[model samples]
Target chain A: MIEVKNVAKKFGRKKVLKGVSFTAEKGQITCLIGINGVGKTTLLKAIMGLTPFDSGEILINGEKIHPGTYEKITFIPDTITMLPNMKIREAFTFMADFYNSWNAERAGELLKFFRLNEDDRISDLSKGNAAKVNLILGLALDVDYVLMDEPFSGIDIFSREQIADVFTSHLIEDRGVIITTHEINDIEHLIDKAVLLDNGVILKEFDTEEIRENEGKSVIDVMREVFQA
Target chain B: MNVKFNNRDPVYVQVIQHFKEQIATGIYEPGQEIPSRRELANQLKINPNTAQRAYKEMEEQGLIFTEGNLPSRITSDEKVFQRVREELILEAVGAFVDSIRTINVPLNEVLQLVEQNYHKKGDSL
Candidate 1:
């Protein structure tokens, strides 16, 4: 499990995350939802130790994140970080060299799943294919947790659906996932839990199925009641 | 296998309801093998944990059973099968009565209309 306890961060004069707390369990998908500039990415970055947090603690399986934690957790940013001149195969090679957790076979399977020719240059791929490659880079790792940042934001509907299909496939394989998104329409049924964020604070956190079963309200309905209020 | 799930209901409950409907209609035969939890999740485009919950509920209710290491199968119990059909019929009739009563329709008139439409629809199908 990944536990974020009272984690807070500040950038110059603006506070990005204020006392954010949540637990994402193994084999479950937890979503962090908020509007733009609400620090969703900042929180994910803080968990991955890519960015510094001013206070509080983040524990992975009850231990503070250290240098070796990279092998257990990975962060897939919204944009592809590879060079435009690199081919998909070359990018795979880059990942293979950088991380000991990289799974070449799973990467090959993901290439077929996304229906992309790895020989195609990154510069020549469409926006949706590029997103698939970006996701593949993170998913192909043999890690216990994956943190994704707005994977569906700028993709086409079909591409968005293909990405959503990943949650149900064996490719995800019982790993804990923390996904941040401003838009929830495409993945309303795919997530196990939701944490609503606004103005650097958590407004609500609840199980999706529990709300639907007990209160007869969807995630959006609760979001409306909380955010609108 | 396509299920257009509503947002307001628990997805696991919806899945159980779907299985009940299929069993009642004989679409899923007795003792027939069903998809694994992961396969069902992919088929329904739902969370795998939700699929697991639905399967667990079904197993507890005796609607399905697993033996040893084999995949789960629909229950072959005749009593449970009959109960599922009867339960679905009662629930559908109850819903129909509730809506029809609100409109102030007489029972005889409602029964006659139901009889007429039911046969017509069945014939057309």
Candidate 2:
């Protein structure tokens, strides 16, 4: 399990995450959902130890995050993180060199699944295809936890469908995932837990299935009530 | 199984309903092996846990059963199959009656409309 306990962060004067705490377990998808600027991405970054937290702790499998944590936890940022000028095949080779967890077979399958050409440069592909490549890079890893930031944002319908398919496929089997997104329609039924963030504070967190059965409300329904007030 | 799901109810419930409808409509035959949990999850693009929950519910309701290590299959017992078909038909009738009752139509008029519409497009019900 990945645990974030009382994590707090700020930039100059503005606080982004205020005592945020949550746990994402293996074999479950934990969703961080809210409007823009609510620190959704900041929380994801904090978990990755990419951005320093002011005062808090992050633990994976009951151990404090250390240098080796990156091997276990892979974070896919919203924007393309690959080199802009690198060809697709070169990018794959670059990733394979850096991480021992990179799976060449999985990368090959995802490349065919996404229908991405290896010869195309990163800067030459369309917005949707670029996102697919980003997803392929993240998913091709043999990691335990995956933290995604706005993976479905600003993509076309076809691309969105393809990305959504990754959740149901064996690509994410038995791995913990933390995804932050304002758009929930694409992953409504797939989310196991939901953390609702507002103004750097967690307004509510609950097992999505419990609320659905007890109150007949979906993630979107709960969001309407929580955000409208 | 091109199961079309809406966002209104819980997905597991919708999935269970879809399976029952499939059994009632003869899409799933008795003793036929159904998709594995992972296969259903991939085919329907739902969470694997949700598919597991749906399969569990169906097993509880005797709509499907597993034999030892084999994959789950539609129930082979004729009585169970008949019960599933009857339950689905009753549920549909109840929904139709409830909706028609809200409009305050007379029972005989409702029956006449049903008879006319049922044959209008060669619908089975």
Candidate 3:
């Protein structure tokens, strides 16, 4: 399990992530939902240790993150980070060289699954294909946890659906996933838990199925009650 | 294998409901092998954990059974199969009765309309 306990951060006194706390369990897809600039990206970056936090602790399986943690967890930013001139295969080579956990066979399978060609240049690919490549980069790792940032934003509907299909495939079967999305309509049924955030604080954290079963309310319905209150 | 799930029900409950529907319609035969939980999740585009929960519930209900390492199969017990069909029928009829009662329609008239439309729809199909 990945536990974020009472984490708070500030960027030159702008105070992002105000004492946020949540737990994302393995074999479950946990969603961090908020509108734009609610510190969603900041929180994910803080967990990945990409940014410094002022207070609180983040633990993975009861240990602080270290160099070895990279082998067990991966963070995929929203945008493609490869050099624009690199071909998809070249990018795969770059990842293989950098990370010991890179799985070439799985990478090749994901390439085919996304119907992407290795020879395609990153700069020349369409927005949806680029997003697929970004996702494949993290998913092909043999890590136990994956943190994704706004994977569905700005993509076409078909591409969004194709990405949603990944959550159900063996590609993501047993790993813990933390995805941040401003919009939930596309993949409402794919998530296990939702942690609602607003203005750098957690508003509500509840199991999606529990709300539906006990309250007969959808995630959006709960969001409306919370956010619109 | 395609299920258009609603957002207001627990996904595991929805999955079991789908299985019950398939069993009632004879689309899944008695003693036939069903897809593994992972396969069902992929086919329906739902979370694998939800699929696992549904399978576990079905197993507890005796709707499907597994022996040792073999794949799970639909119940071959004739009484259980008959009960599943009757349960579906009664549920549908109960919903029909509730709606017709709300509209203040007599039971005889509702039965007559059902008899007329059921065959007409079946023939057209």
User: Considering every candidate listed, which one attains the maximal DockQ?
Assistant: 3
Name the weakest run of 10 consecutive residues (lDDT summed) in model 2 chain B: B1-10
Q: Candidates sorted by lDDT, descending order?
A: 1, 3, 2
Worst 10 residues of 3 chain A by lDDT: A164-173
| TM-score-best of 1 and 3 | 3
| Candidate 2 residue-wise lDDT at B51 | 92
- Expressed as tens digits, the lDDT of each residue in A1-229 for candidate 1 is 9999999999999998889899999999999999668599999988888889999999998988898898889898988889999999999999999899999998999899889999999999899999999999999999999999999988999998888887678444589999999978988888999999998999999999999999999999999998889
All models, DockQ values?
Answer: 0.80, 0.68, 0.86
Model 2, residue B49: C-alpha shift (Å): 0.7
- The numbered model that scores best in TM-score is 3
Native interface contact recovery, model 1: 0.80
* lDDT (C-alpha) at residue A145 in model 1: 96
Model 3 clash pairs? none
What do the candidate models score in CA lDDT, each in turn?
A: 0.92, 0.88, 0.91
- Predict model 3's lDDT versus the native: 0.91
Among all windows of 10 consecutive residues in model 1 chain A, the one with the lowest summed lDDT is A164-173
In model 3, what is chain B's TM-score? 0.97
Top lDDT hit? 1
TM-score-best of 2 and 3 = 3
Error of 1 at A7 (Å): 1.2
CAPRI accuracy category, model 3 = high
Give candidate 3 regions above 4 Å deviation.
Answer: none
Clashes of each: 0, 0, 0
